[model samples]
Target: MTTERAYHHGDLRRAILAAALDVIAAEGPTALSLRDLARRAGVSHAAPAHHFKDRAGLLTAIAVEGYGLLAATLQKAESLRDLGLQYVRFAAAHPAHFQVMFRPELLRPDDPELLAARERTRNQLHTAVEGYSDDPAIGVMAAWSMAHGFATLLLSHNLDGLLDGRDPEEAFLSLTNEMFQSAKNPATG
Candidate 1:
């Protein structure tokens, strides 16, 4: 067997999670089944349950992982604009994680790891946005809305013709630059 397959077969938690992510990415979270994940992971039907109590617990784990990844991604940004770009890139790259991370109703709201991971990502965004405005909260909201909204649009194909064959990230940079320029010149804004 390949090394990666061997590792998954040896690590049930990771195996189940990997299978769950695949199912979620292919058919959305509602289609995920612990039993199916266990079968795919080469474990007993109850194996996934031992690690994640139920579908919500499994989803909470996914959310925690997603937020941790997002925190790491955002932490690497040198500027607010870079942070926004990273946020969009992250969502585009991890659509399954992105889908689960925002759906609070589908996860265990009290999961400590999930809460901490979410806070870490949020704090990173807040810190990045604070440099641009006196009210960091508002800046954070605006920046996150723009980036997340843009990502959603791109993922849903809502921005189809608007892209005009331009790469998504390049288009985002161009749009952000225009917005910044407009903000600098009120008459144009």
Candidate 2:
């Protein structure tokens, strides 16, 4: 960061968080350092301290951003099946955020913004499964597990053979549709 700075240019917080995502995507979160983030953002090493206090703060920022993005993604998908497919797509597109967003042990969960964002994400998912009133909790939990597991497998390439050369979008939709079939009772619909 330019030591010669004014409020107009330093927007250090956004810069640091963007750089952290870039570094995490390329090298994983464990490789993240406040200094490395500063270097990546072309800021002086001390600049990040003004925004993130420490590495944990940086992580909390990442998690908060991840939750906000997740909430947006799930909100956009009009159906539970679509939301599940989008979850897989999100994991593929934003692996860095996806990697640590759900791992509660990695960051301080009590951070108010993080908690609020996370709750928003959960509510988005809950709304997606709203049609399954017959067994809402079980259906929501099962749907959540299926989507999370399939996305994890698909993004990780563990399901490479199962994909059987299908286009990724079609494959994601197919898997989610199949999962939806199992999660909700057909007689009710």
Candidate 3:
């Protein structure tokens, strides 16, 4: 009789998540599979399942992690504009996480950890917006829309020609400044 060796890793969960991120980055989230993650992690097929019951659970974990990272990034901003810049920077730096974080359909949104992480990030955004605008809600929405849209455009290559050799961050900052300036003086806009 042949005996299968026990799976032993320093941190199987983190390993699997790292593998999953690589897969998502290279092929989008739809192509991710626990089996493939295990293969990438060099573990047994069932190893990933032990940590995450299914794809939803795995994705939920990723969403939670993404939110935590975003919260940390936003918290470091010195101003509302800096917050927006950080948001775009985070999205660009963590494209895989950014892709998964906003797709509620792909995650178990009711997961407590996911909820907490999301709330933390949202609070960071709201606090920053509140400091800058008379209408906090509208400010929050506009800032999020601008940052998310800019990141999406940059990531999808839609801004390739429009950027015209400018650094993405500099272009985003300039665009943000222009929009805010226009908002301040609608007649000039």
- Over 1-189, each residue of candidate 1 has an lDDT whose tens digit, in order, gives 643465456677787788889999899999999988877876678868988989999999999999988887887788888888999999998999998999999999988898889888888888788769888888989899999999989987899899989899999999899889888986833
The Cα error of candidate 1 at residue 55, in Å, is 0.5
Model 3 spans with C-alpha error above 4 angstroms: 1-7
> lDDT values of the candidates?
0.87, 0.79, 0.87
Question: 1 or 3: which has the higher TM-score?
Answer: 3
lDDT string for model 2 (148-173, tens) is: 88777876778899878888778767
How close to the true structure is residue 134 of candidate 1, measured as C-alpha lDDT?
84
TM-score of every model?
Answer: 0.91, 0.84, 0.92
lDDT tens per residue, model 3, 1-189: 111222353477887788889989999999999988877777778878888899999989998999988988888899888888999999999999999999989999789999999888888889888767789989889999999999999998999999999999999999989998888889843
**Which 10-residue span in candidate 1 carries the lowest summed lDDT?**
1-10
Clashes per model (N, Cα, C within 3 A): 0, 2, 0
lDDT of 1 at 166: 89
Residue 73 in candidate 1 has what lDDT? 81
Ten-residue region with minimum lDDT total, candidate 3: 1-10
